[model samples]
Target: MKSFRRHTESHRTDSIGWLRAAVLGANDGIVSTASLLVGVAAAGASPGTLLVTGVAGLVAGAMSMAAGEYVSVYSQADTEAADLSRERSELEADPVAETRELTAIYVGRGLEPALAQQVATQLMAHDALGAHARDELGISEAFTAKPVQAALASAASFAVGAALPLGIAWLAPAASLMVWVGLTSLLFLALLGAVAARVGGASMAVGAWRVTFWGALAMVITAGVGRLFGAVV
Candidate 1:
């Protein structure tokens, strides 16, 4: 007799939910905080003022990210639930039609009609709602909306990202605060993009360039506005 091995595969789809929230939160945190500090510094704000503003921006950004993620994800969860409920009712009302629908879906996916019908029949017999939810509605355990999880990940990542520029602002020489914050924040954004790309199985260079470009643009515009205001005032 030969020994058999049961192999399991892991995919990035499982991490999509939290990964999206975390990346968005951290990117926003770094860009917004760095821009805020650079803008203020360009306006000749005192070190004390820069520190206060950076801290305030960090706190506000984190809270906003949390609230935004929670509300949005909760709405998604609600929609998914409503869809599942409707699907369940439809399945109960006309199980035969639902089976046909599932069969059509599988057939569309390249299975022969008769084979699709057989597969759909077996799956529905085993778990009708599960079949409909997964096949028809495109909802699955791995892709389910998780509001609390998204909220926490967004909030925590935002705070951590914001802290990088904030700490630099607090420590850098007052005259060159903007320079330090801008450069360091760009580096932070690039690193974040690379890390996120690695996790999501994307090209690291592309991800880093994408994030760094936007971050740099934001800081430049903000700094220009601050300089204009400083000169006028």
Candidate 2:
């Protein structure tokens, strides 16, 4: 049992699909919603309007994220399924040719001709599809995507992210709602960047600054537009 545990640990890859999705989703949720609120508030919109805009932005962003992720992942999933089907057909129709092809793949990878052929023969006899899937297609159980999972994750994270800004509008003073919201949102942005960087094994300073910079720019732009409108009115 201990040996099995150690073996699994050693095989662990630096990346995982769910972890990526979760980090991405949460970050999107926070940054996008915050920016939207800041922009609206800067325009000098009413508190009621800001709240409504925030809610609308959250819902719209969440749905869009989910739909986009679903379509993208579904396309990839379809491609993979097609490849697996074709491989299955090849396995049935002309296995000898397939074996030779697979053997050549092993040989190209650095094994000696005899060793490659022997390994290919044994692997094919055992589970040719799995071997090809790993070596040829680069698809493995660890990396295989789940469209539903990605879609849901992105949507859920967006909503959560948007919620922070919305909450600020509710709790902060209306007279200075934009200022408070902007400050709070930027804080969240920096924190999220740091946390995401940590999770992704990247430099925290770079990550935090990168996300915060975009978010700050977005808010500033929106505020500018709002000021112009407020001035004209």
Candidate 2, residue 160: lDDT: 85
- Candidate 1 regions with alpha-carbon error over 4 angstroms: 1-8
lDDT of 1 at 56: 96
- TM-scores for candidates 1 onward, in order: 0.96, 0.88
- Relative to the true structure, candidate 2 reaches a TM of 0.88
- What tens-digit string does per-residue lDDT give for candidate 1 at 1-233? 99888755778988999999999999999999999999888888889999999999999999999999999999999999999999989988999999999999999999999999999999999999999999989999889999999999999999999999999998898878888999999999999999999999999999999999999999999999999998899
For model 1, the run of ten residues with the poorest summed lDDT: 3-12
Per TM-score, the best of the predicted structures is: 1
lDDT of 2 at 228: 79
Clashing pairs in 2: 29-161, 30-161, 43-226
What is each predicted model's overall lDDT from 0 to 1? 0.95, 0.84
